[model samples]
Target: MTQRHDIRLGADIGGTFTDIALDVRGRLFSTKVLTDYAAPEQAILDGIDIVIRDAGIAPGDIGIVIHGTTLATNALIERRGAKTALVTTEGFRDVIEMRTENRFEQYDLDLVLPRPLIPREDRFAVRGRIDAQGRELQPLDEAALEVLADVIAERGFGAVAIGFIHSYMNPAHEQRARDILAGRLSIPISISAEVSPQMREFERFNTVCANAYVRPQMADYLSRLQVRLKEMGAGCPVFMIHSGGGLISVETASEFPVRLVESGPAGGAIFAADIARRFGLERVVSYDMGGTTAKICLIEDYQPHTARTFEVARTYRFCKGSGMPISIPVIEMIEIGAGGGSIAWVDAMGRIQAGPESAASEPGPACYQRGGERPAITDADLVLGKLDPDNFAGGKIRLSLDNAGAAIARDVGDRLALSPEAAAFGIVEVVDENMANAARVHAVENGKNISENTMIAFGGAAPLHAARLCEKLGVERCLVPQGAGVGSAIGFLKAPFGYEALASKIMGLSKFDAGTVNAMLDDLKATAEGFVRAGTDGAIVREITAFMRYAGQGWEIPVTLPDRAFAAADTAMFETAFKQRYARFFGRAVEGPEIEFVTWSVKAQDVRPEGERFVLETDGAAVAVPARRGVFDPASGTVLETAIVPRDTLCPGARVAGPAVIVERETSTVVTSPFDAVIQVDGTILLVRKGR
Candidate 1:
């Protein structure tokens, strides 16, 4: 069992599937397994066994393992995490509960805000105060903290979160409180300053509480995964991908599990960004449709858009401000509960509605014949003849068309007074429109046109619906990359060892001090670099950003700063940058309002080699069709004979006309009647609109 440094493994545990990808030098081997809820790690192990066997490599030969999961997010959403207590400043005990007091749904008088993670009884307040200028306003009551620690110990709380007023500016009080609690309690303790150091008490407090809520569960899961992997002969160091689309040591992940909330989806964005870079596409709409959820992200200039804060478990139609805010660096994306297993049912309004709930992997879709009585999106896809009944998941799990048809007929067809095929078509159309509307909203929010961007579709279910999605969005081209089924797992292998550190220090342009700003930025840079160094000693790249806003404004926009030391003369440059960015965001900038810098961020990452350029082939010879099948065409509103081509047999420069199914082991790409498919030099399937 000789070690092979070139052998790296990447695993992503989604809600419905655990995808494993093995990279043997430049070659890739991948597989997907049904997620085991009771023992999630078991699915990863099973997937690993499959890929390693296919790659002809032993577990001991693996050099490194990169893993991502949705466990932390699910815990918060399901309220299944450990019992947690919140310790905050006396008057600010209700910060998380109070939220920002903004109405996400203004017209609904009965709207109920999401309950805080820590119940009111579990929240304790102490005597402490830190001013906005990082100055101590009141001394922390050490005795109060010691007494609270004893109370926490006696109550058997699994985790504790401490978030004092203005802790982001001065963390001395919060640190002291955590030290007192750690000495008395054996449970994990989290401080808001370390979890989310930016301003805004509501978001910061909620972030730390969320971290503490899931700390015990995530730590236990990650520990068990490592132990199991070691038992199976994989002794390589394991790293977890964070929500920022970077690899961090498992130790860091355990301490800051909140950062891993969007880890799996971040990988998908990174995969699409890499594909965009290779193909030289400047603006790409990254569409990832897995079994339980679908995510859409905007990638521009060969990088996925990033944000300093994002919400989790949106409860109101995935509306902004309707979920728990996590103030951590993350890749920005819009996620909807529209996936293969998303449940579809007729609403009270007699309209077909897809999910914010899913069957997940346990029962899966009705077509899986796993005791799921309800019809799901997968059942609709099956009933519509988009999926092959005999060869799903490479035939490892046989699909039952009878089961699918029966479920749809019982639930939707009978209720809607339509045949199963028609009902299935209606269901698919509803879900697709849901996704398309989401994409449209996301692009408009970002001030971009959806039709102007090329789409890069991945995940098992994305390609099956991508062609139709393109038609709806008026997108001219879509790229279904190689190994699309396990795109996120493959993304983990491509991610760099990186970290982002954020801090808050209010500074007005009129009173700007270059020395103070430089010192703060230097501290942040060192902190980010230290985290990156834990994983690699390679050359590092640094990026700096300033969150800026006009005086008396409630929100700010990010302005990227030059990656160099600033001087007193640079104040005007900073003002100019903010003005330009502000104009771009709002179409105009106010000249009289004084500008201020609210927050600063530093991101550091180890450099990696760039991928080779991909040349798309437009003119190619038609490929031989292995078979033909009766597939439903939405454009024609009828089932038509379509060519089915084996993906493995199609070489570079191969082309297939519209109404074709490019079949592969992991997933299939359905080229609709309006588009034609061409095999690129890198084995990517390019779907272009007819006469484009």
Candidate 2:
């Protein structure tokens, strides 16, 4: 095992900012910088240098570095990945195009479904047939792989994804094809059996195709990042955070890069979960609004709820089936194209709308003077006095109020016949409402209530808009954790080193075969252990899981297996537990039909994160006030003078009322008309709805 004294680092790259954190004995230091999407590694190195300096440590003293990024997500959204191809069994070339057959907008006949990741021309099929029971009905032809490899290479493709029929049940054929294609092409390969070992050919195949599409780009960037870190005298073992709220080695991340799609937002969810645990809160909603997007995730009972599938790079706003599906264990959340940098525009109907298109960092906003002419949410916030022009990004970058107001006035105000300030408020309110609507839909779909969940707000822009969001959701309280500006980076430290392995197999409880179940479980254990061994050196690991199902009738809810593998004698116990879980999810369980298991999952995790907790110093009380600022309030329908209080001045138990501003070095949290906040024991400010 590695020594406990080694220092660990974590970095998260977002659309608007790149965040970095250093954890030495569980004490975290962090920093945020503008993301360099053109050369993403540069921002990573810069943030690393800042964080290492903040920790007062030499770069060479660092031991392990874990990174999380939205790069793959962004690349898919912006269409910047390598040209890729998908090879599948004959007659299944249109599987991705066919999709789920459910229309996102059932009423609109003209609605265009999202385009497939691989075009029709890029899709090739081979002759092979595997049945549902892992039986090969038609033998795989060895000659086809060579022909496909030549055609794939001739097209100058960078990566290829192979997803044959029933590969999830038996991967032998896919493995054979991969071996045959190894020497014929230099491109990377992704097999559905390894990427998503589940039923549903459309989703599994899409997941593998997405992974292959982004592998080459992710690998090249990671290699350059490693070299740059070493050049700066840091010889740390780099780690990457996966979307499942766990950490894995960078080498594993480079191979299966699709898992990193929601990696940044996943880190934020972990941070929120940790905060919930510390404060003893049972239900919390993590709100992370960075430069280009805002993410909302629900955490309950000190852990975030995870999903087996996620959609990436959706074309339409708030549409679920509008994106390609990736089958992996992910901390389920809802994301929207509403953030500080989301561009605002006046539509043909003259209705002002905030984005699903971001200006990004290079040409951030009109206020940044980086050649951006479009009006953005941040520009509007500055125009309405919600943001301090001089204190933006800890005063590292100055905002131009004239440019912001002028852009909003010319772009939106002129069309709506309103003043720039009114237009700016409209933009802010519309974006907030968009985010609020997304949150409500997500919660409703997951069989949850938004009002019952506590809101944990982070990211550079979240603190500024969190109180408003809480009001919109009817949430009683909100938590703004310390270092909220670089929330995802801090979240990286809170994550555990782990991996999830899954497989789909048919099993009927009526004729339950203990041997088959045990064998399948063993195979899953071996796969998880193989990944863990590559990342950690003899670390203690535990396997846990549940069987997936629909309630009652023919399916069973996920019943957790015992620590040891299943035995023939335990079949009755398993059935009893499944009945209880089924009743819990749905009101009751049916007694007549036989229960079936569609798929099973196994997750391996370390005993703890890479360090021991260190005691932190708590602040006493502040003795001074900053100043006052007049801010426009929509609730009041006018501008009012509001007191500005620095966050550092408030101590634990100190209370602040609404119509006040709590400013910090990195960002500000606004206490609005009906909200009041009190500092908690752990230095987190808890904002609760108050009776005025």
Q: Best candidate, lDDT-wise? A: 1
- Which numbered prediction scores highest in TM-score against the true structure? 1
lDDT of 1 by residue, 450-508 (tens): 99999999999999999999999999999999999999999999999999999999989
Give per-residue CA lDDT, model 2, range 567-677, as digits (tens). Answer: 677768867887888787777876776667788888887666432232222223333445778887666767778778888878776777667788876678887867777
Q: Model 1 residue 503 lDDT?
A: 96
TM-score of each: 0.99, 0.95
Q: How much is 243 displaced in model 1, in angstroms?
A: 0.6
Off by over 4 Å in 1: 1-5
Model-by-model lDDT, in order? 0.92, 0.83
Q: Residue 237 CA error for candidate 1 (Å)?
A: 0.5
